[model samples]
Target: MAGKTHDFLMVSKSILPEAILKTAKVKELLAQGEVYTIHEAVELVGLSRSAYYKYKDGVFPFYEASRERIITISLLLENKAGVLSHVLNFIASVKGNVLTINQGIPLQGVANVSISIETAGMADTPENLLAGLGEISGVRKIEVIGQT
Candidate 1:
């Protein structure tokens, strides 16, 4: 593998084949402690073990690739008391180190926020971080805007 050349692309999940998507799910299930073995994870996600093994080394969430780096997340939140606090608290809960935060003035009952976090110390994947943030009451939208 040392002399091999590789290329990569960031693709929308909607356009990916089912086997690839399920392979990712199987990996996630194992990573998140939802399943103890590859066999269990593959069965749970309805992915064949052979397919999982074929793609497992190559298929991973973008966040997994960005581990130990800095990531910026852009979010829109309802303009209300404690909304930003909740967001910050959630980041802290996952051991994410907040490097900078910028919140724009609210418009139409929503405020735009961008937070830069150092993921080296994060206890969870950025994918899970975004998911948890999305579940917060006032968060309108969330996405990873940049990473380094």
Candidate 2:
């Protein structure tokens, strides 16, 4: 880190929408090893580095914005049979189109999973989507880590 630092926010820094906040979060996660590196990070967010960097510190997308969004959800789950299946069923029940799902091998009864989904045709709003997922058994933590 050097030079006169600049925040990457593109949209006004008022009440940020959900998408930008979600994307910035991805950047943070990548930095913190919560997620991985650049290519994965941008892909996870469905944003070009240009767009992501543009709003990395500023704009955000919301549940309302999620209607047009393709976002990735990261989960920390208990390593148990039917856990991932149940999660997928919940996502499908809400009409979330599964884009990609990546899961690391279980370690110490826990597995970290990253799933990307398109919200365009979802029957429920993103907030409701999250709530539904939260209710499922074995799903410990969920975060909309990226969106565009």
Candidate 3:
């Protein structure tokens, strides 16, 4: 059923069914750009395309799952030299990996900046990260816009 809910579990790869494991491998091939087409990837991983499609969305390597926890933060920054750089350095000090940064045109001495950061390796929680950003000299305001 379209509205059905599914239960998920974290299981060791050693105990995973061969087809599921192969599905993961196929996905890896595609993600790394080693194979241009699904046909090629599935063949390389010894899986059928149909099976790969079935499990691809459901299966992910544990490290990938952990690494994909990302947060988008919006900042109102003073339009001054090195402000963005300082903000980035602060995030790095907390072990946040910045994924994307978009800064809008300065308006009335302030610029809106949106940054997406991967927090898996961070030493602090998201709230602490926001607090740290807020403490930067040129940052006027900070808010979390999204997370996944």
Candidate 4:
């Protein structure tokens, strides 16, 4: 016997079957905190609980599915007065939303800085952003530490 292999596809809403679309609505209701329980959400979306449960894990709106567009980058920066600010400014210029930043104490004239950013609205791809960061003065190194 052979094991099942699952494949995924991106389909436009115009052709999606009703059950899958209703499942997406249920998820949206929960995410927006508009409904408290599965039953309420399923009812609001005109879907049965069983159907919601069946398709919930498999069907998602494009935005919901791609919402995990966050990345954390670690940088080796010169312990200079404006190096960190420059890095932040560059990120803003590229439309990257900065979520968190952590900087370690300077050691040997260098500091370790980690920045987490949401890249959904970024004008450049992750690689392009990294390349731009590398071009900034005093940014010694740049590498992606995490992504989700």
Candidate 5:
């Protein structure tokens, strides 16, 4: 059979601004060393270079209120030297600024620790942070004992 077909298709989908949808692309470029300069990242993201520069410091996903509430988190960790440090690291990773730490002597292979965190500048909500802490290995228990 000798036949030829030519068809034109119309695709109607609205495309929004790439920068507004996926801001991480620009960040990934910087992280992976794919883009060395802001000029390059802005062009890659199809956003105005000036806009990228102006909003880089302020555009964040998690919005936290500057309330006077300081969250007190209690963690039951395995009796290991690094376990407590690891929990602290996790808190820092989530941008939870540590205010104070109190740890009881290890008893029965576990240590009870209380950490007061200032999460005003953190991106993740306090609940999400607690959930992440609960997932940490060697953490037997995690509880938000106080929040105000």
Candidate 6:
């Protein structure tokens, strides 16, 4: 599944067109049990059934985008104590399940670290997780290396 992950972009709803926005709302209504069927959800949101189907698979809230996904992130960190520990703690704090971690030997005051995490139970989106990690001390660089 390493090469099968779809790329995603985070967009502001305020900048989206109405049909797309309505399609997302229809999905929310159905997912939250506010509506019984797709037909009902679409109707509640003033979206046509055809439009709902068109966008349903493509549009979702940020929290749902990474749901059930496994993502690999690569980081460059300073050769300092507790940097890796802090990274792991941050992942756990957001309920990200760390599946594997590979750390390279430090050279010239920096180390390359790759972490694969299961995001099914994470409380935040992958984008947010990356942003949070970038804020921690000793983090020199962060980027998503892969996903599935």
- lDDT of the candidates, in the order given: 0.92, 0.80, 0.85, 0.85, 0.72, 0.89
Residues 10-111, model 5: lDDT tens digits: 222235345544354566577679999877887877878766665555443321222335878788999976888888898899788999999999999998
Off by over 4 Å in 2: 1-61
Q: Could you tell me the C-alpha RMSD of candidate 5 in Å?
A: 16.3
On residues 3-29, what C-alpha lDDT tens digit does candidate 3 reach at each position?
897555657789999999999888888
lDDT of 6 by residue, 37-83 (tens): 98888777788888877887899886576679898899999999999
Better of 1 and 4 by lDDT: 1
**All candidates: TM-score:** 0.68, 0.60, 0.55, 0.55, 0.54, 0.64
> Least accurate stretch of 10 residues (summed lDDT) in model 2?
5-14
Clashing pairs in 4: none
Off by over 4 Å in 1: 1-9, 18-58
Clashing pairs in 5: 69-148
TM-score winner, 1 or 3: 1
Q: Write model 4 residue lDDT over 11-86, tens digit each, in one string.
A: 7788989998899888888988999999899888789989988887888664444344888899999999999999
The model with the greatest TM-score is: 1
- Best candidate, lDDT: 1
Task: List CA RMSD, all candidates.
Answer: 4.2, 14.4, 12.2, 11.3, 16.3, 4.9
Q: How far is candidate 2 from the true structure (C-alpha RMSD, Å)?
A: 14.4
Superposed Cα deviation of residue 119, candidate 3 (Å): 0.5
Residue range with the least summed lDDT across 10 consecutive positions in model 1:
1-10
Better of 2 and 6 by TM-score: 6
Write one digit per residue (lDDT tens) for candidate 2, span 1-148: 5687544322443576655665766766676796667778877767667767776654333564567678899999999999999999999988899999999999999999999999998888888888889999999999877877
Give a tens-digit lDDT track for model 1, residues 44-125: 9898999999998889888887789898999999999999999999999999999999999999999999999999979998
